[model samples]
Target: MALFFFLTAQSQNKDLPDVGIIPKIVVKAIGVNTDIQGIIKNDSNLFKTLSSELIIISNMGAKNASKAEQKDNFSIAPDEVKIVATKNINVADTDNIIVLFLIYEDEKLIARDRKELRRQKNDPNVSDGLEIKGLVVENVRSKVGKDFYDYFYQQFTLKNPESDQLVKVEEQLGIGIGTRIQIKVQEDLVFESFARPNEEQLVNLANSAVARVLQYFKQKERQKQLLRQF
Candidate 1:
C-alpha cells in the first residue's frame, strides 16, 4: 500500500481575491492476490475493514499558512488510489512541502512502500468549503443483553475514511446492537446520530454523518457571511 497527498490552489474569480484550494490523496494497493474488488462489492463497511487490516501512517508539513482536508468520495482499484486532499491545507513557498506515507498490510505482515511528496506553494486563504474533522463510532450496545456485545462491537466500530484519527469508545448497556456517530471539528461536535448496528445500517450511518458535517459547515459559512454584512 502506497499513498500520496497533494495540496494546491487556484483562483476561481479574477475580480475577487478568493482562491479555490483543492487537495488530493492518492493511494496504490499492490499484492499478489489482493481482493480489492471483492471488498468493494461484498462488504459495505470497506473503510472499517481496511482500517482493521491495514494501518496507514501519514504526516504532512506546510510552510504556507493553510489547512489540509480530505475528500468524502473514496474509490480504489488495483492500479491506484486517488482522493481529494484539502481546501484549507496550505503549502509553504521556498520550502519543500512534505507528506510522508507508510502502508502496512495485516495478515500478510509485509511492509509495502513509503513515499514522501514535495508540493509547490499555492494560495491558502480561499475556502475549499470542506471542513470535516473526522467520523467516529461510539456508545456501542446490545439491546438484547451483554452476551453479544463483543460480536456487535466488532461490527460497529468504523474508521473515518477522510482522516486517520481515532478516539476512545466506551461500552454501554442497550436493548439492542446499535451505535451513535459523533462528527467533530477538533473537540466540537458538528453532527450526531444513532442507528442499529448492521451492514446496511452502518452504511446509512456513515453517509448521514458525512452529510451532517457538510451541512454544518455550509450553515456556518452562511452565518459568517451574514455577519460580515454588518
Candidate 2:
C-alpha cells in the first residue's frame, strides 16, 4: 500500500454554461486502479438538451513524459445525471501524476476540472473575461421588441461570452411604425436602434448588440487598469 492525495482544480474564467448543462467529475482510488466518473447537471431557469464530450487527460510523469487520454460522447438533459465515463487507470510507481477532465457542449468548451497528486503543472491559461456588473433588465412592451429580445438573448450568451455581466434591453415607441431598442450596461448605453426589421435583421441586430456590449466593458476595463498603474 502507498499514500496518495488528490487536489482538484475547477474552471477559472467560466461557470456552468448559460444553457445550464454542466459536467461533474468524480475520482476515487480503488486498490491500485484509479476510478473516474463523469456526471452531467442541469441547473435552473434554462431548458437545454445537449450532447457533449467528456475528456479525461492524465499526465504520467515518467522519462518519456507520456500522457493518457480518453474521450466519450453522451447526451444529457435537465435534472438527469447520465454516467458519461467510468475509467479505471493504473498509477505506476511515482506519486507525481495529474488527471484533467473537460466537458464540451456542442463543440464549445464549457466546463473543466482536474485532480492531481500535486501541483506539477499550472492550469492551462484560460483567457479571462471582463467581470460585468448591474442587472439584466428587459423592457419588452411589444411584439417587435419581444422578437428582438429573443434573438439577442441567444446571440449574446454564446458569442465570445461574458463572465459576469448584466445587460439591460430597453424598448420605446419610435416616431415611425417601428419601435426603438437599446442595450445598456449599467448606465452606459452600448447599443440603440430605431429600425423595425424582420427576423433576419433581428439576428444581425443581436450580434451587433453583443459586440457593442463587450466592447463597452472591455474599454472600461482597459481604462481601469491604466488608472490603477497610477
Per-residue CA lDDT of model 2 for 48-137, tens digit only, reads 544444444444545645565667766555544455677776654434556566666667777665545532223333111111222255
Error of 2 at 62 (Å): 39
CA RMSD, predictions in order:
14.6, 14.5
Q: What C-alpha lDDT values do all the predictions have?
A: 0.32, 0.60
Q: Which stretches of candidate 2 lie over 4 Å from their true place?
A: 1-135, 160-165
* Candidate 1 lDDT over residue span 78-137, tens digit each: 322222122223222213233322122232221121223333224363222222223233
**Lowest-sum lDDT 10-residue window in model 2:** 126-135
**Candidate 1 lDDT score relative to the true structure:** 0.32
Q: Indicate which candidate wins on lDDT.
A: 2
